[model samples]
Target chain A: MFDILIRNGKVVDGTGARAFLGDVGITDGRIVAIGPELQQEGRRVVDASGLVIAPGFIDPHTHFDVQLLWDGAAKPALEHGITSIIPGNCSLSLAPLKADDRKTLIGMFQQIEELPPEAFTQAFDWTWEDFAGYRAAIEPALAVNVAPLVGHSVIRLWVMGADAQQRAARPDEIAAMQDLLRECLEAGAVGLSTSFVDVDENARPVPSRFAQFQELDALCAVLGEFGRMLQIVPEFYDTDITIARIDQLAELSLKHRIPTTLSPVFDNRQSPNNVPRTLARIEEQTARGARVWPQMQTRPIDISFSLLRPSLFFARLPGWIKVLRLPVPERMIALRDPATADRLVADVGEDGGERLMGRLVVRGGGEAPDHLVGRTLGEIAAERGEVPARALITLSLENDLSIGFLAANGGHDSTERIGPMLANPLVHIGASDGGAHLTSFSTYGDTGYLFSEFVRKSGALSLELAVRKITSDTAEIWGLKDRGLLKPGFAADVVVFDPQIIARGEERPAFDMPGGGMRYVRDSIGIDTVLVNGEVAWSKGSYSDSATGRVCELT
Target chain B: MALSLQRRFTTPEPDESLESLAARSLPDLPLDVAMEHIRGWNLHIFLMRRPRGLLLGGDVVFIEPPQT
Candidate 1:
């Protein structure tokens, strides 16, 4: 008897093939059979009529490293049909650390990913040091399959100790790093992830940046031994540097004979040639038989923040960042001080932040007035006869510092421009930044947005092609086996969704973090059910207490 | 299957200072002149990143002048 049967549904199969009416049979967590009018008795049957049954989405870039220890399903990620996640991207992970290094690593995570401090202290036990120990800690609690990448910064920290951040490694330290990378590869890490652009809490470049080219080459050689993948976050601001990094990655890929990818190739209207030029480089590398996939997110860049915490929106403005990073009393004092306010206003530019902070829409949060909810700060500031920066501060102070603001469509907004780039065969559709920018934006709904905007609305890609992009394409890029397809003998990780209505729900604040912190989350709109390894992980707008997920082993 | 086309460039030689490397790569120019041109050409590395002009093995040190 089959364990479960998904009956009478349109199966897309994650192969970019034509969809057909079919029934999929599952047994012992594998899709045993898939065809029309399948005759099999099942312990449970899912009525997927009028829904599209496709392979479960594989989110390639996420930072669910710490969150998966507490919320195994990765919360709304699983609910939004992401069954397999590749965490530990951009040179940060939660393993291969000494107990003394916990505070340091936590600070990196807090600074780079914007995770609250209580996320580390208040939830779950940090009992792991090596990759195997880290895997063991989260193995039993996983509801979404994880194919983790061992971070390069952590590996450097494990080997060179304090010197990892100070300077380039010695020859012996490089050898030690190679050995540690090999150990991590053997212990179920799918690849190695590094960064050229991330900074720690003190605003210093992360340890991975300190490693010279030779050190990275040594690590990639170890990855080559297992034919694994390598992921990096390049200096994405400058196109020339990013292209240089791409060339470097291409060289490593060619030398090591392993696949490599980089995230967040954003489309900027300012530098229109940036993405095209980078894509041109990628194309050249691909022509040279080097696999260099550039991962791009489907959603527009919309940042929402309140004065309650230090947000990425204010990252460049040092005074605002310092004030927001402080405790409530300190932040209030800084905001109230006229001298400090004047300095902050000066920092906002000569127009008194009219150009930068003028268009920010006041998103009514706790205690904010209803009348000012949807109005721009420019409009409100003019009424008060105050500069936008000063007005923003005054408004927040009036609301007990709980009023939220949204900076929408900063870039990556033009559909006509971004559609063709997304449709490019070389562009890997990912970089959701899930579980990291928890408070800044809803990272869980990018996949949904891809379907809603690209597939259904703009017709940039057909539904089948879009499914393949997130499923098989992502799985192939990350080297995840058996989880991205819905065929016989494959893992029955699947999602049933309405094609017409599939989209991200409203972005709202949810105070569910380890600390009493709040994050903007958008619920999945049209996902009817999600299955991981043939078990129903989510169904009917709720979740099942099933922990069927396991650590993915890369051969 | 059809493939895409793109430009190809090389990095500077090992242990070569930016000036000499630029002189060798851009041979028609003088050493100091070549170094100034190189710095101007690659502001991303020469100015933006710290420890300015610290070239790596894999850096894309451009040899040509600005196209536009």
Candidate 2:
């Protein structure tokens, strides 16, 4: 008898094929059968009428490593139809890290992931020092499948101690690292992740950035043995550097006979040539029989911030970022100083921060005054008889620095320009940064936005094609085995959703983090049910107590 | 299809300083001119970094200005 039979649905099998009326029968956590009608007996039956049944979506790039420990569902992620995730992106993971280095790694997570220090200290116990031990700790509780990438920085730290970030590795040290990487891969690491752009809490470059090209090549050799993936965060701010990285990755892919991916290829209107040039390089690399996937997110770059913490929103504004990085008391003192305030204002140029700060709307549900909450900072500046920068400082000072502001549609917002790019076969739709950027923005709903904005509004990608992009495309690129499709013998990971209304809800603050810390979240909309390995993990806007997800066994 | 060449860049040698990198990467030019051009070509190094121009081993230091 089938354990679960989903009948009378329009099945899009994630092969870029057209949708058709079908029945999917699941037993023993695998899709046992798929056809027009099934004469099945003794099971739960889900009537998926008027709903599209497809393979559960897979997010290729994420920082769900830490969150997976406590919230095994990775919360809003599983509810949004993501059954599989690859965490430990951007050269940071919790495993293969020494106990003494925990504080150091926590500081990096705080800086990069925007996580509170308590997230590491209070959320979970320190249980693992190697990849296998880490897998053991989280696997039993997980409700969403994880394909973790062993971080290069962590491996360096494990092998070279403090010297990892300080200098290049010697030959013996490199050999030791190769051995360690192999051990992690054997222990179920899908691949290795290194970063060129990320930094620790003190603005020191991450350990992965200290490695010479030879060091990376050595690690790639280990990945070659397993035929796994290698993911890197390239210097995406510069077109030439990104292209150079593409060439480097292409060379490694060719030599190693393995796939490699680069995260966060964005489209900036100011530098209109960046993406086109980068994409051209990627196309060239692929044509040479090298696999170099360029990951692009579907959502516009929307950032919410206060002067309370250092935010990447002010990355281009060096002076503001510098002061904002200071400790809270010191930051307050600096903000109050007249010279520092003037310099920060001047950093925005002669328009007195009008062009940048004018359009920022005061975000609600904060310590901001009721009357000022929904108004733009420029409007508030005009009313208060001050420049926008000055008004921002004075208002924050008045409210004890608890006022939040949102810079919506900041960049990469043009759907007309971004639509065709999303539809590009070479472009892998990922880099959601989900479970990272917790306090800064909601990274949970880009998959939903892909459907609502690109497929429905812009008609950039057909329904079946978009499903294929997130499902089979991601699985094939990462070499995930026996998942990302609806066929007999494949893992029974499925999502049933109404095609017309699938979307992401409004961004709101949820005080669900350890120690009651706050983070932004968006609930999923139009998703009817989600199944993880033949068990109903989420159904009709609620979650079930199902711990059926596995650490993905790679191809 | 012929792959068009992008702008040229070089990674720093182990413990290499900006002066050494400039001399090594731009040997035809005078030392001062090479240093100036190297600094001009990579603002992410000379301008954006903390303790600016602290050359790391993996940095992609550009040898020339942005190609026209």
Candidate 3:
């Protein structure tokens, strides 16, 4: 008898083929049969009428490394139909780290993830210091499959200690790092991850950024031995530099005979040539039989911030950063001072930040007034007879510096332009940055947004192709074994969703993190059921107690 | 297929100073001229980073100008 049966759904098999009505049978945590009207008995059954059943989505880039310790499902990620996730991207993971280096790594995590300090201290036990120990700690309660990447920074730290961030590794240190990486690969790490552009909480470059090219090359040699992937956060802001990094990745890929990927290849109005030029380089490199995949997110960039803390949204504006970096009491004094306010306003340019701050909507769920919520700063500024910059300061001072504001679609907003790019076979649809950027924006629902905006709304890609992009394509790119198909004997990781309405819900605040830390989250709209390894993990707006997830096997 | 050339760049050797890197990357020019060219071509390193011009081992120091 089948363990479970999903009946009469439109099966989009993650193969870029046409969908057809079918039933799938599951047993022993794997798909046992998939055909028309599976004539079988089952212990349980799922009615998937009028829904689409596809292979579970794979998110290639995430920082769920620490979050996975407490919330094994990665919270709303599994609810949004992401069954298998690749965490430990961007040169930060929570294992192979010495107990002495824990504080240092926590500072880096705080810098990138913005997770509260209590999350580390209050959430779970830190018993593991090596890759295998870390894996063993989280494996028992997992409800979503994980294919983790060993971090280059942590490996450097394991070998070179404090000098990991200070100088280049010596030849002996590099050899030691190779041995450590080999151990991690054997311990079920799917790949290696490094970063070129991340900094610690103190704004110093992270350890991975300090490594010389030879260091990265030596690490890649270890990865080549295992045929694992190499993921990097390149200098994506600059086109010339990103192209250079691509050339470097291609050379490493060809030389080591392994696949490589870079996150966040964005298309922006300011640098319109970034995507096209990068894709051009990728094509040129791929034609030479080098694997250099560029990852791009489907969702437009949206950033939310308030004056209660220093946020990177104000990064380009030096005066705001300076004032915000001050202590809270002093910062309030600076914002209220006429002389300081005048200088700050003047620094925003002659238009007084209208072009930049005008469209920022006053997000509610904070100290913002009922009437001010959902209203744009431009509109409020006109009513108050002040420029947007001055109004922003005044409004925050009035609200005790707790007013939340959102700059929606700040960049990568051109769905009309991005559609074709996403459809480009060479472009890998990922870089969600999920489980990081928790407070800044909702990183939970890029997959849902892909369906709603791109497939249903813009028709950029057909349903079958979009499924293939995030499923089989992602699985094939990362060398995940047997988890991205609907064939018999494949892992029964699947999602049932309404094709016409599957989407991300409105962003809202959730105080669900350890220590009740608040984060912006989006509810899944039309996902009906999500299955991980043949067990119903999320069904009809609820999570199951079944912990059927395991560490993914690599090819 | 032959990949088209990108802007030429190099990473820093261990504890290498800018003057030394300038000497190594642009050997044909005089020291002062090579340093000036290096500064001009790599604004992200020379201008943008805090403690400006503080070189690191992993920096992608551009040796020539932007191709376009």
Candidate 4:
């Protein structure tokens, strides 16, 4: 007897083939049959009439490592129909750490992923030190399957201790790292992830960046042993450096015969050819039998921030970031002091922030006045007869620091330009950074946006092609076995949603993290049901208590 | 599928600093004139990223004059 049967739906199977009317039968957590009519008696049956039933989306980039320890479903991601997630990207993970190194890892996560310190300390018991133990801890609680990548930074820290970030590894250290990587791969890790551009909380480059080219080569060789994946974050700002890194990755991929992927390729109107040139290089390497994929996100860059926390807006401005990073009272005092405020305004520009701060729109949030909402900083500054930067500080001080600002469409805003690129066959549709960049933007609904914006609205990609991009294409790129297709013998991970109405919900601040930390989140719209391992995980805007998900193994 | 449609151009060698690079890539102008044109052309880098004229190994370093 089938465990579940989803009947009467348009099945857009993940193979990028055309959709057809069908019913799917599940048994033993696998799809046993898929056809026009499947005569089966089941323990439970869902009437998915008028909904599109397809393979659950696979998100390729995320930082759900710590969150999975506490919220195993990965919350909003599972609700959005993502059954499998690739976490530990950009060289950060939770396992293979000594107790003493907890603070260090916490700082890195805080800096890179914007996770609060209490998330590591207050949420879960820090019991594990190796990849196996970390896997064991989260296995029982997971509702969405995970294909985690062991981080290069964590591996270096495990082997070389504090010296990992100091300099290039010697030969012996490199060998030790290779052994550790092999152990992680065998312990259910799907790949190795490294970063060249990320830094720790102290602004020193992460340990992975300090490693010479030889160290990474040794690690890639280990990945070759198991036919696993290698992911990296290159210096994306500079196209030349990014292309150079692509060449380096191509060499490693050719030598080791392993797939290498990088994120994120942002579309900048200022540098029109940046993304195009990078993709061209990727193609050149692929022609010579090297597999290099560049992952791109569908969402435009919209950053919303308040003085409540350290934000990406203050990233390059060290003085503002330092003050924002301080405790509330100290931060307020620093902002109030004339000397510090003068330095902050000076940092904006010699024009006293006429250029940098003028474009920020007053987004209403956290006790902001209704009058100021939707007004630009430039208008407010003109009213006050002061420069935009000075007006921002003066206004915030008056409001008890409750005002918020938004920098919308910082780049990647032109839909007409981005639509064709996203629809390009060679472009891999991902780099959502889901579960990271918590405060800056909502990464949850890019998959839904892919359908809403690109498929339905813009006509850039057909429904079937868009579904395939996030499912089968992602599976094929990552070498995930038996999960990304709706067919006999494949895992029964499925989503039922209305194609016309699917999109991200409104972005709102949710204070659900440890120590009352807040993250901007968007709920999923138009998704009716999500199933994992043939069991309902989300239905009708609520989650079931089933934890049928396990760590996925790459074959 | 054709991957991209961008024309790739390489930065000239060292001793071929910005002036020499501009003169060679845009040979119609003299050295000093070419340098000024190059500076005016690529303000996004030469003006934005600090140490204004700091050249890296793999920089785009455009040689075209400013767009009017």
- TM-scores, all candidates, are 0.86, 0.91, 0.93, 0.82
Model 4 agreement with the true structure over A1-555: per-residue lDDT tens digits: 689988999999999899999898999889999988788877898888888999999999999999999998998999888999999999998877777888889999999988889888898898999999999999999999999999999999988889887666778988999999999999989899999767788876677876767778899999999989999998788776677678778889999999999899889898898888887788788988889999989998886777877887777888888988999888889999999999999888788777777899886545667777778899999998988988888888888777888887888877888888887777888899989887767789999888888999899898999999999899889988888999899999999998879998877777888888878788999898999988999998999999989899676
Off by over 4 Å in 1: A303-359, A364-404, B1-39, B45-68
Which regions of candidate 4 fall more than 4 Å away from where they truly are?
A: A305-395, B1-68
**Two-way lDDT contest, 1 vs 4, winner:** 1
Indicate whether candidate 1 or candidate 3 has the larger DockQ. Answer: 3
Q: Of the true interface contacts, what fraction does each candidate have?
A: 0.13, 0.57, 0.78, 0.00
**Candidate 3 interface RMSD value:** 1.0
**DockQ, in order, for the candidates?**
0.22, 0.68, 0.81, 0.06
Each candidate's B-chain TM-score, in sequence, is 0.75, 0.92, 0.93, 0.65
Which residue window of length 10 is worst by lDDT in model 2 chain A? A34-43
Q: Please give the distance, in angstroms, between residue A433's alpha carbon in candidate 1 and its true position after superposition.
A: 1.0
Weakest ten-residue segment in model 4 chain A by summed lDDT: A363-372
Please report, in order, the local distance difference test score of every candidate based on alpha carbons: 0.87, 0.91, 0.91, 0.84
Candidate 4 falls in which docking quality class?
incorrect
lDDT of 4 at A38: 86
Poorest lDDT segment (10 consecutive residues) of candidate 3 chain A: A112-121
Give the poorly placed runs of model 2, Cα more than 4 Å off: A305-359, A364-366, A369-397
Please write out the lDDT profile of model 3 over residues A1-555, one tens digit for every residue: 899999999999999999999999999999999988999978999998999999999999998888889989998899999999999998999889999999999899899778777788899999999999999998999999999999998998889998888888899999999999999999999999999888888888889988888988999998999899999999888999899899889999999999999998988888898899999999999999999999999999877789999998888889989999999999999999999999888989999989989999998656889899879999999999999999999999999999999999979999998989999999999999888877778889999999999999999999999999999999999998998889898999999999989999988778888888878789999999999999999999999998988999999
Query: Listing every candidate in turn, what is its Cα RMSD in Å to the true structure after a full C-alpha superposition?
Result: 4.9, 3.9, 3.0, 7.2
Q: Is the docking of candidate 1 incorrect, acceptable, medium or high quality?
A: incorrect
Per-residue alpha-carbon lDDT of model 4 for B1-68, expressed as tens digits? 44342323344353246766676777887878878877765554478644476443224455543221
